[model samples]
Target: MFEAIKLLVGVVSLIMVYRTITGNCNKYLAFAICAIWLRYFLSAFHTITYPSLVAGFSINALGSIGVAGLGLLLIPTAVFTLKKLFPFYVFFTAIAVSGFVNMQIPGTINVLVKWCYFLVLAGALFLSIRCQGQNETFKKLLVAFVMPVSLQMLSIVLGEAKATEADGSTSYIGGYNHEAAFSMIIVSFIFVLGLVNRNAISFRTTLFTVAVVLLVLVNYRTAILTILPIAAIFYFTLVEQRLKPSQKAPVLTIVTMVLAILFFVLSLSMQERFADVGLLVGNLDLIFKAPMYFSDAEQDIMSARVYIWSQYINAFTNADLLHQIFGFGPDSWKHKFDLYAHNTYVSYVYEYGYLGFISFIGLMAYILTASFNLSNKPLGKILAFSLIGFMIMNMATMPLWNIEGLIFFALALGTVFANPSAQKVSKEIGAGHKTSMEIN
Candidate 1:
């Protein structure tokens, strides 16, 4: 009975989000739905045990279907809405279709699901680029889409920390640890969107600050590192110009550097009493000493990745001609590894072979090229950069296939690529110049 109610709530929530994306109702309704979904999913995951009926059957099947439906609704709304503003929607659709075909093979439903979700997000991103030409109200609406997700992430972090303190065990109900990292990525995009809009400087700054603090608390090293370069690019290209001549960029940089050094030193100094801090520092030390220990280390990170890549590559190459061209059907990798390829590039190669790989790359290239051309709009530029950052991070991480990650990515893309009905509205409001200026 409880399971049925949960499933019903999921369906209703997704409908609300879809309506919000379509501009058919109050946008806040969509935000509420996303927040509820995030919270419920997290709690549900935490309470359910692994390999149990709930995890393997109910959550994996019905829950995945609900998430996939949400993606489908958003992607179409983004593409159809922005078809005129961004012609790349056609190319993205083509790639998605090609991927779907390649993924349709037996035992590959999981892979197909992932491709469907990603394609939806790509389409939504195209729409977001289209909508950037609209007024500030549209931009605010985009931010609203992400705000609830971010708050839900914060809640997960707090709840997870409390659970850990009480039980002395790690719990990622609904994959909260990974979702938290994914939320950081989404918040980073929101920060860029806020920067581009410029109408909400204070709000954006506060959110960015909150995101940074949360990121630190979560201590997801890869996420922190992945965002650093993007933050640097944003600071230099966008934030620095807005600063007064008297403001010292170097001072801020030095202060951050000094604080980092002090924090590390303090953490090491307290190693005797704080086993957690000691473990963290010890891990950092090992990472730094990787080069020196490469020969002796039992597990070599770089070598392990190369080995995995080689295995996937060899598997694809050994396939028969028909399999090579059409690829092993969706979820085929499970027969061999019982899991995904772990690397997106390898995953694509393994699932779709070379033909599908080219088509996927071509679609990504098309969207990126179109986005670059539309860089005149701050929001467009930021979205383009964020996508690039996301792609880089995905090379080493598989969060791209996760539900929370896909939803956030799709929503952000939709915001940037939205097709507004009010092109003339911007011209009448004297916002045309802002949209027409060169990014550089």
Candidate 2:
């Protein structure tokens, strides 16, 4: 019975997402529905009822694939890039070739599956860039999408939920984990939204303040640390300059900064009591104490990420040209040992080698640089900050592989890149560039 309900909810969510992208209903309404569905499905349905059979085809996985496919289909309709589809084609082609090579090498099928998912993620991002261009009202709709998620996160923090892993170990849902990524995305989204709508100073300030508080409660250190600083930079560089020289803007900025600093300090103070942070620290200490407790002290450091990263770095020190070019293949690292590098940069270099890693980095750099260059308008500034937040989160966490993160990134990107007018529009009603005709 629970399985059936879960499936039904998943299907409904997908339909709503479709309607939203196609602009059938108010995008904000559709986004609100989707956010509610996701929160309930993850928190209520997935947790309360364990339906193994139905769970085999989980909503999260299916949604990831579906969004990617849909994005591919819409590429041709985008007006921003003449051959807009080519970037996606090249990106996925690399994943496919590398994935196949990994499969042929001695390793588990898990590697292939992971890369395939990443390829789909690339597709989702491509579509988002397309969508961002065409969807002028995305800023308003995005606020609706983020509100419920923020409220749900607040509930978890206040409710004192236990943080445990499948192996009965303490685990903080840190960077790249589903919860952390979701929180980061929403907070970043809100910040950007606030900046874009800065003309309504009270509304924007209220929203930004709320977002910062929620960000602290989420207790994802990387998300909080990375986003807050970058957001401040973005605001000063882009949003602050637009405001008139008055007592209001400076006063508000000072208040915002003080509150942000206070929140950061309070969150750190509370970390000792938080279950996830305690567990994570405990585990790290245990993993580092192998020398005195056991004879096989060498393997003790395997579980320590710092140790593993050092090892990976050293492993590549004497690697040959061919190995550097083609890489060790997907999941090959796991086959050699039962550990992961836990860092994206190291993981990419180890799996795909130097050439592949450089190519991937270059692609990301191009996307980021291009996006930053285009962020001349109010909406564009929001998109730029959001992209920066996303990039920062990815550096520490692996949400680039997750469905939710991928889709959100895609939506933001598509909306920005697909619309030429997005670049030309001014934040001020009658400043800079204007025509007699306006959307009103």
RMSD for each of the candidates: 8.5, 7.6
lDDT of 2 by residue, 1-440 (tens): 43453355456645645655567444333433344345334533434432333436455445444433443444333332435334544544555556566564433243334334444333333344343423334443453343334334434554523342222322222221335445545554554455353563446656665666555555555566556654565455544555566755776678577658865776677554333444545565543343334334334332344456555656665577766766777656766656567566777777777766776777666666556656356455556666676666664455544444554555555444444443344454447655322112
Off by over 4 Å in 2: 1-59, 74-89, 104-136, 143-160, 164-178, 184-204, 233-242, 245-303, 315-320, 331-339, 375-382, 419-440
- Residues 1-440 of candidate 1 have per-residue lDDT tens digits of 43344345446655655656566433333332443244344434444522336534544445555555675765444344543333434434433444466555334455456545545544534443443333343443443334334344535654543233222333222233344434444444444444454454456556655555555444443454455544545544555556576775775566557656755674475343334323434554433232323343323343244335556666777778866765665556777774466566677667666666666666566556555555245545655676676666566455555554555455545444443223433664575454432111
For candidate 2, the TM-score is 0.64
- In Å, residue 297's CA in model 2 sits off its true spot by 12
By summed lDDT, which 10 consecutive residues of candidate 2 come out lowest? 167-176
Residue 81's lDDT in candidate 2: 40
**Residue 294 lDDT (model 2):** 34
